[model samples]
Target: MANVENRGNGSYRLTVILGYDEKGTPIRERKTVKAKNMKEAKKLLTLFEAEILTGEYFKAEDKMTLNNFFPQWLEKHAKDTLSPDTLQNYISILQKRILPKYGHFKLEDIKTIHVVNFINDLKKNGQRLDGKDGKLSASSVLNCYKAFNNVLSCAYRWKLIKENPAIGAKPPNGKAKKSEVYSKEELSQLMQLLDDKPLFWKTLILLAISTGAREGEIAGLEWKHVDFEKGTIRIEQAITEIKGKGVQIKGTKTGKERTVSVPEKLLEMLKKMELTSRQDKWKVRDLWEWPDHFFIFGNEFGKPIRPDSIGQWWRRFTKKNDFKHIRFHDLRHTSATLLINEGVHAKVISERLGHADISTTMNIYGHVLEEADKTAASHFELFFKKMN
Candidate 1:
C-alpha cells in the first residue's frame, strides 16, 4: 500500500513502493511532488503507483523513504552487528517516536529543518508515556534522540542520504539525573529489614551492597565461582535478557572479568547458603545433574531465577514496609558511596565495581570524591595550624 504525507513546504511525499528486487530486497521508489492539498497529493500518488507498477519509474538507488529502507538497515546493518539491548532500544524509539513522524519522507528529503523540528518536538513533549502523570526526563529525551540519530548516521554511511540531518542538529540538552542511592542510616535499616526476608533475597541484597556488582552480574553467579578457602568470587559472565532471546549467559558489558573478595563472616554465610541450596537440589535430583553449572541463587528447580524478579521484589518489599523505595541497582551505588566515604582508594573501588576504567568511578561518584577532597583539605588545615 502507498502512503502520502505532507512534508511542509508545498510538497508531499508519494510513497510508491516498488516491489522487491531479484535479491528479495525492497525497492522503495518514493517521489516528492509539489502539491498544495490532499486531493493533489492523492492524484500524484496514484500516478506514481501506476508508473512504478508498470516498470516505468526510473530507479534511483537513493530515492526511498526511511520507512522502506529501515527494514533493510535492520536486517543487513543492525541485526547481528548491534548489541541485542541496543537493537531493541532502536526498535522502541522507532515505534514510539521516529516512525510516526518521518517514515513517509525520503532519506534525501529529510533536511536539517526536519531534524531540528523533531528535536524541538521532543523537548516540548517530554513526558512519560507510561500510566504515570509526569513528562519524560531530559535524559530520556536525549536517549530517544540518540536512537533517531543512529539511524540517520547509518543511512549517511550507506550513501542513501546526501547529508546526515542529525550531525548538526542541537543535541538533547536534558540534565543528567543523579543516581539514586541509600543514605547510611537508610542502608543500615535496609539490611535490618532484609534480615527476616528469604535467604535468596537477603543474600542478593548483601552481595549487591557488599560487592557493588550489577544485578545481572550477581544473577549470573555460579556456585563453582566461589572459592571457600580463597574467600573470592570470580565474575566471568552475566545472565541478561536479550530482546528476542530470553535470559542468556553472555560476556559482561565491558567484556572484562574481575574477582571480588568476600568478608570472612559473609563467606561463612555463603557457605551456609550453599548447604541450603544443596538440600534443595537433593529434593530435585532429576532436574539437575552434577557437572552441569549450578546457579548460586536459583528457583525451586535449581534453574536461574528471572533477573528482573530481583528488582521487582525490591520494589514490593520497600512498598510493603513503607520504606523509601530505591531500585535494586541503587544498592550497588550505596556500596560505592559507602566505600568512598570510608576513604577507600578510587582504583580499588573501580575494581570492586567491575568498572573497566577508573574515570567511570570518578565521574559517577564525583560528588562523593569532592566531599572526600574537602575532608582532606580540612586535615591539611589542622596540620598547618599545628606546624605554626
Candidate 2:
C-alpha cells in the first residue's frame, strides 16, 4: 500500500509499506517529490509504488554522479571495445564538453530537458578550443552529441538510469563536405609537371592519382606488395601516427585488404625506384635500420617515410609550382572523378577506392553521376539528330 502526504507548497512525501521484517516490524520505502496539487501527488505516488514493486526503484545511496562513473565506464567498456583513435576522441569530447557541464549530475537526475538544453547550448555558443573566434563547427557539435549519447546509453545499459535522456535529444545537422578534384585537363597538366620532379615524388603522386589510395596506405606500401607482372598493388596496411606514440603500422582504415591495378608506366617507375633503393641500400649497408621491412617509400636508412611528411611535401610542391591548391587527399578524389567520367561502373570504383559498399561511392559522387547522366542524354539526342 502507498500513501502521499502534502508537506506545504508543492512538496509531497510518498511512503509505501511492505509486509513485515524478521522482527515483525514494517518494512517501509519513502521518497519526496514535488507536484502542483493533490491529484499530481497521488499520480506520482502510484508510479513510485509501481516502481518499487517491480524492483526498478533506485535508492538514493546507490546513485552515482557522471564524474564518478565515467572512469569506470572507460575501463569496463570503452577501452576494450573502441579503437585507440576513437577512444581518444571520445575522451576529448567527454572532458572538454560533457564533463564540465553534467559530470556532477547523478545519472537518474539527468532529465530529457537537460540534454536538450545542452545540445541547444552547443549550437548557439560552443566556441572552438583552438582560441579561434568562431563557434564550434557543426561536425564538432555532432561529435559531442554522439559521445554524450554513447555515455548515457552505457549508463542505461548498466541500469544506472531509468531512461537515457540523450536518446530524445536531436543532434545538429552537419552535411558532409563536397570533395575537391582536378579536372581531366588539370590532371594532365599535373602529370606533365611531375615528369621533371624527383623520381620519388613523381612515383608517389602518380600512385596516389592512379590507385585512389590514402596517403598512409601509400606510405605503408612494401616492395613485396607490388606484382610487376600483373601490374597490381596489394593494399593491406597503413602507417599512422598516434599522439605521444609516434608512428605505427596498422591495418587499413576499413580493416579490409584490397588489390588495385596500376598503369604499366607507373610499374616501370616503381622498378626504377626499386633499383635506386637497392643501390642506396648497398651504400648504407651497415647503416640500414629496417633491412627486413623493405618498404617501397623507405628513407635512406630503410624506414618508411612518415605519413605526415607526404602531405607536408605536397603543400610545398604545390606552392613552389604555383599550382591551384588542393589537399593531397584531393588527388584520390581526382582519381575517382576521372574514373566516373570515363564511365567506370560504380561498384568497380567503390572496390578500387576500398569503400565498404557501392552506396558509399554513389553518395560521395552522386553529383558527378548526375552530370554524367546529363552528358549521356545529350550524346543520345545528338545521335538521333545526326541519323535523321
Candidate 3:
C-alpha cells in the first residue's frame, strides 16, 4: 500500500508499506517531494497512486538481488527466442565468466562501479580453466558486456531494478583491426592451393567466392534451389553445427528466401558436377539417400555435407598450401571486396550476399570501393600523360 501526506512546510511525503520480505519482515520506503501547496501535493499523490497501481513502486521484496532471479528469468523469458548457438554462448559466459564473479549477489547489490571493475578483472584474470593464459580479447569481453546488459535490460523491463546497473558501461577498446582483402595474385595462389581437395568442397569454395554466399548457406545448397537454366541460386536454408550432431540444416539467418545470379562459368561447372556426382552414387548412401533428390554440394555418396566438415576441409587446404591465415568467412569478404573494387555497387553486392540490410553491405564494402577509386585514378593519371 502507498499513501502521500502533506507535511505542512511546502513539502509532501510518499510512503510505501510493503507486505513482507522473503523472511517475513515488514519493509517500507519513503520519498519526499517539494510542492507549492495541498493542490500540488494532491497531484503528486495521484502520480504515486498510479505508480503503485501499476506495481512500479519499489517495495522491500523488489530489492532482491539479480542472481536470485537469473534462473527464473532464463526459464521464463529467454528459452524460446534464443537460438541454440546463441543459448550456448550465453550459458558459457554465465558459467565461466559471470556466475563466479556476481552469481551470489542480488540486483541491488550490483552497481555501475561493479560493472567497471568486472571488465578490468576480465582483462587481468590471465588464467583460464584450460590452464591457458586467459587474456580475454577485447571483442569477446565486449560481447560478454553486451550479454550482461541484455540480462539487465530484461530485469529492468520486469521491474526487478529501479534502473539498470549495467547500462552506460563502456565497451572494451579493440586492439586489432580487420585485415585487408586478398589481392588478385594472392587469390590465384589460394585457389591453386585448392587443386587437390574433394571436388564438391572445391565447388563449394568456388560458389562461395563467386556468389558471396555465407558458409552455412553454401553447405545447405540443394539442386532444386539452383536454376542452371537462369544461372541463379536461391538461399532458403543453412547447415549449422549442433552439439550432439555434426551438422544440422536450419532456417536461413534472416528467415527469408532470396535468389542470387550465378555466372555462366558457374552454371557450366554445376552441370559437369551433376554428371560427375551421378557417376559416383554409392559414396553417401547412408545419409541423404533420397531418390530423385539433388544436392548442389553433397558427400561423395550423395549425403548432405555438414558446414563444419567444409570448414575443416578449407582449413586443411589453406594449411597445406601455407597460405595466409584467414577464415573461410573471409572468402565471402573477398568476393564482396573484389566486386566493389571492380566498380560493382554495394546494393548489388548486398543482394548477392543476401544481406538483410543494405547499410550493412555499405558499411563493410564502402572503404574498399573508395580504395578502388583511388587505384583507378592513379592508373588513369599514369596512362594518359598528355591529356589536355
lDDT of each: 0.83, 0.89, 0.76
Please, what are the lDDT tens digits per residue for candidate 3 over residues 302-338?
5677676767877787787788867788888888998
Model 1, global lDDT: 0.83
Q: Return the top candidate by lDDT.
A: 2
Two-way lDDT contest, 1 vs 2, winner = 2
- Flag regions of model 2 displaced more than 4 Å: 1-56, 124-126, 278-292
Candidate 1: worst-modelled 10 consecutive residues by lDDT: 122-131
Error of 2 at 78 (Å): 2.4
List runs of model 3 lying over 4 Å from the truth.
1-54, 61-64, 125-130, 174-176, 254-256, 275-295, 300-303, 379-385
- Give a tens-digit lDDT track for model 1, residues 90-147: 8888877788889998887888788888777766643466757666778777878888
Q: Choose the strongest candidate by TM-score.
A: 2
Root-mean-square deviation (CA) per prediction: 9.0, 4.1, 6.3
TM-score of each: 0.79, 0.83, 0.78
List the pairs of residues colliding in candidate 1: 126-136, 127-135, 127-136, 128-135, 128-136
Q: List the pairs of residues colliding in candidate 3.
A: 65-106, 65-107, 66-106, 66-107, 283-301, 284-301
How well is each residue in 1-388 modelled by candidate 2, as lDDT tens digits? Answer: 7899999989999999977899999888999999999999999999999998877888898899999999998999998877666778999989988899899999888988988888788776536788767777778888888888888999898888888998888777776577688998888889888889999999999999999999989999999999999999999999887778766788787888999999999999999999999898899998998767788999988988888999999999889989877999989999999998889988999999999889988988999988988988999999999998
